[model samples]
Target chain A: MSNILEVRGLKVMYGKSIAIHDINISVPEGGIVTLIGSNGAGKSTTLNACLGTVPATEGKILFAGEDITHASTAERVRRGLVLAPEGRHLFPYLSVQKNLLLGATQRSDKEGIQRDMEFCFELFPILKDRLKQKAGTMSGGQQQMLAIARGIMANPKLLCLDEPSLGLAPAVIDDIGNKIREINQSKGTSILLVEQNVHLAFGAASYCYTLQVGEMVAEGSVEEIRNNDVVKKAYFGG
Target chain B: MGVIPNIMVNALVLASMYILASLGFAFIFNMLGSVNLAHGAFYMLAAYITYYLCAKAGLNNWVAMLLAAIVLAAIGIVMERFVFRPFQTEFDRVVMVSVALMTMLQQLAVQVSGSQTISIPAYGNGVLDLGFMTLTNEKLITFLVGLILLIITLYIVYRTKLGMQMEAISQDRLGAALQGIQVNKVAMLVCGMGFALAAVAGAMMGAYQQVSSNMGDNINVRILMLVMLAGAGSMNGILITGFLMALLDSVCPIIWDSYTASAIACSAVVVLLLIRPKGFFGHEM
Candidate 1:
């Protein structure tokens, strides 16, 4: 399968300090890829670089066939490259429906947007009843679901989610994991999930990459990553 | 007019005018997260422009007010693009730039019109009898027009797609950008709208009362109080607080001397702020 996203030798610096260096990642079309790392591992920096929020000091980010390293965040989003950022950054004071509508800002097709709204309701039925409720008032798990649903509303070719399972309960994490897989299987949308939750990441992603500090340490199938002694010991707690 | 009715009318008229002027100031404060110290200058400039158009340029008072709003809006867009955008997020530097802008505008006003006080020709002639009270046609027109504009402004804010975008940006700028809402473009439009609203209020007040180069200096304090007491991220609160502020302005003088009334009113606001630091209905910015 052709890769939907390719990040080659990506390096990001904040002033004199390097956030991430010499990093490469790819997500195949219709596949789920995850980057897993602990705190201070530069996972978010890498994700922000691909999203064009932070400037990449070196390297190229190619979306489908286009070199988008120099593109603006809005341009990247317009081309179906979307990021549901970490911390569940939903508009807290806004109603859930307005939050959902904001996600589809790039599109104008009323029918397509309506269809997507129904799809979201189907995926997370609780969201339907809470449509008029303020987003901030929702529970953590529901907020995380809304974040993913918001990203899906963008109708992205590649949806990059940062830490969807962070602070969610075990059962909620499992449900979110299933939804990530369901989205890929049903919608054929590519996903690039960045998580510190090893179990959730391993369950959702077919291919995985592990980063330590600012550099990639391993890249393999989920099965291969699960068996690797060093990665297993460090991340899996085995 | 009875004393009670006169006081009530004064409060209502003052509330409407201040609410119109403060809406723009509130928008810039919430959306840009910067204090536009030059906002009062925009108001002052509008009054002067309306005065010139009506008195010297042979235009109708209403037409001149509209023209003043347009001119100030154009200047606002230019200032947002060239002056404000670059210094955004640097609060101190932005304040300095706005203060500089205020001084320049004030100086220009003085050079053009000097220290002499001027007023626009009344929008309406004769008096309107409202049973218990009689009001000059000019005051009634100012009140009615100000109230209508305020309604239209609120409607645009609450019932429009562009308004939704503005709300999203004010809440979370990065989140708005992720949705492909162009921040700079929206910011420019907001600046233009803000100045236009201030212009209308200034022009209306010019006809109702008098205009001087330093008039903005006095109104600036009231604008600041309105926004600060309303807190951040809450536009609806401005309406309530605007009326409350006007009530204080109107009623306080009747009970005490002007100086004592000013002191008592400010002290009351300071006390209320102490009780609810986030104003009546606002979250942390």
Candidate 2:
């Protein structure tokens, strides 16, 4: 299958300091790919570069056969590249319904938007019940769910989730992992999930890339990454 | 006029005008996270434009005011694009740019209107004489127009999709962008709306009072106090504080002189800020 996204030799810089470098990653059509790393491993930075939030100083980003290296963030989002950013960067004061509606701000197809709204409700029913509730008032897990649901409302071609499992209970993490897989399988949407949680990454993603200190150190199928000695020692604390 | 009724009418007029002007200032402060010191100058400029159109161009008062508002709105969009957006994230630079803008606009107002104090014609020229109090048509019209404009603004802020996007953008800019919101686009519209509202207030006040070069200074200070006391992110706070501040200004004048009224009202604001440093409804920036 053709890749939905391909990043070649990507390098991102923060002033004189480098955030991520020498990064090459791809997400195949209708597949789940996770970039796993420890703190300060440039995982979120990589996702930011993809979403055009942070400029990539060096490299080419091709999405579905088109180069998007210098596109504005809004233009990129309009082209169906979306992110559920790290720490669930929700509009805390807004209601859940407004949050979801904001997710579809780029689109004008009313019917399609309604259909996606229903789909999001199905993916996380708690959101529908708390439609009028402030997003920040929800528990962490529910906020995460709302964050992802908000992303889904955009009906993205490639949904990049940044650390959805962060600050959640094990049970909630498991629930999120299942939702990730279900989203991919059911909608045939491509996903590039950035995670620190190796277990959730292993369960949800078919292909995995291990990032260490802003570099792509390893890339393989889930089983290979799961059994890799270095990944085990570093991420799993073996 | 009876002192009680006079004070009451004056308070209502002041409150409505202050509220209309400050609402725009608060939006700019909340959304761009910057202080546009030029906002007052913009207010003053609108008054001059309205005055020129009414006096020189021979347009009807309402049409002249509307045209002046449109002109300011267009200038507002340009300012947002060239002036405000570039320095949005740098608070110090934003203030500096606004101060420079304020100076330029003030100079322009002086150059156009000449240092002489000019005023717009009364919107209406009649009075309602009741047994208890007399109400001038001018004051009644000013208050009613201001109230109607305030209602429209509230409706736009609370009841529209664009308003929801605005709320989202104010709370979390990057998050709003990730949701595919054109942050700059929304901001530009907000700037236009804000300036338009300022223009309307300026024109209304121009009719109600004499227009001086430094008229913006007093109103700006009052707006700053209202926003500071209301806090950073709360519109409702501005709504409440606008009336309270106006009431203080109006009531104190009846007991003392205008100078003492100003002092008392300002001191009350200072004390309120001392009591709530973050403002009554503000969250952390």
Candidate 3:
């Protein structure tokens, strides 16, 4: 598979404090790549920088061989890079259908948008049933599902998800994990999964990277990372 | 019969103007989360521009009103780009800039117009007798114009793609940007629309009352009260509260002394705000 995203020596700072430092990662097209780390490990920061939400202090980000280091967030989305942020930032007051419609704001293809809306509804039938209901009134699990469905409406080439299983019950997490795998296998949509749940990450990702304090500590196949002592000690707590 | 008809006409007229002004303020406040203290100045500038174009520049009053709206909208775009854009999150700085702009506009108007009350020629000069009552043609025209504009504005807000983008931004700015909605462009459009709406209100009010340098001061207070009473970021609430305020404005004078009417209105808003904090239909509660 070809590399669809490349981050070279990226450094992101917030005022005087450094949020991420000298991080490099490459994601190949059509696979699940997970970045597993503890809290304050700069996983979310790296994802945000890739999406152009946070300005990088130095280095470059290339999407599909195109430099996107200085691109605006909206421009990044236009180029098919979409982020399903950590907090499931759905428009709380808006209806589920409206929230999904907003995801296709950049695309003018009304037919394609409509098809994608149906695809989302097919994936999560609950959303279709609650299409007119406000998003804030939904359950946490349903909101998570809606968030992923909203991302799919953008018709992204690469979807960056930040902790999709953050606070979900184990059963819900399993369902989400299966859906992520199904999305990757069926739709050929590449995913950059930033997650703390090692089991879920291991289950969903083929390639995995371990991040510690803004640096890539380990990068290998899932089986290799599972065998790494550091991964076992920190995440699996052996 | 006479008192009821008079009150109904008064309420409708006042409601029309209040909705016009409040909607403009609501647009800026909801989307950009800025107070836009210079909004009233924009309104005053529109009245003065209409005055200048009609009285001095030899333009038709209707044409001047349209021109004034366009001109103020252009100024609004420029201000959004240069003034409000840089001061996006700095609330106090934005407020200071707006206040300074308001002061400059007031001073400029005073210098140009010399503190005199000048009225734009009425759009209509006659009166219509409706069975038991009489209505000035100007009042009827103003009320109809306001209603038409309000319907158009509401249509643009609810039935257009731009409207969806505005609602999305107001709800979640970062999320909207992530979805490829241009924040800066939307902000500019919003500012232009806001100022244009205020300008229309100013021009119409100039015809109803007199255009003067300090005319904006009184309307500015009323605009603020309407927005607060409606609560920020609630379009439906704005529509509801606008009429409520207009009703208060029309009826209070009949129930209380003229001097105490505004005070009573203020007290009612305060009491309601204390009880609900987020107005009647606001989502933020």
TM-score of each: 0.93, 0.93, 0.96
Q: What is the DockQ score of candidate 3, to 2 decimals?
A: 0.70
Runs of candidate 2 with Cα error greater than 4 angstroms are A229-238, B107-115, B129-132, B283-285
Tens-place lDDT per residue, model 3, B167-206, is 8888888888788889889989988887888898899889
Report per-candidate DockQ: 0.55, 0.59, 0.70
Residues A1-238 of candidate 1 have per-residue lDDT tens digits of 7889999999999999998999999899999999998898999999899988899999999999799999988899989999989997889999899999999987899999999899899999999999999998999999999999999898999999999998989999999999999888888999999999988999999999999889898889999988988787667666
C-alpha RMSD values across all candidates: 2.3, 2.4, 1.8
Model 1: per-residue lDDT, tens digit, B1-285?
398888878888988989888888888788878888989889999999999999999899999999999999998899888777887788898899989999999999999998888999888999888887898887788889989988888887899878888999888888888887888898899889989999998998887878888778767878888778888887888888888988998999999998899788888889989998878868742
Candidate 3 stretches greater than 4 Å from native: A233-238, B254-257
Candidate 3 residue pairs in backbone clash: none
By TM-score, the better pick of 1 and 3 is 3
Give the higher-TM-score candidate: 2 or 3: 3
lDDT of 1 at B127: 89
lDDT of 2 by residue, B154-223 (tens): 8988998788888888899899888877889999999999999989999999989877678788789989
Which one wins by lDDT: 2 or 3?
2
Taking chain A of model 3 alone, its TM-score versus the true chain A equals 0.97
Model 2: per-residue Cα lDDT over A1-238, one tens digit each: 8999999999999999988999999899999999999999999999899888899999999988899999988888888888999988899988899889889887889999999989988999999999999899999999999999999888898999999999999999999999998999888889999998888888999999999889888899999988889888777667
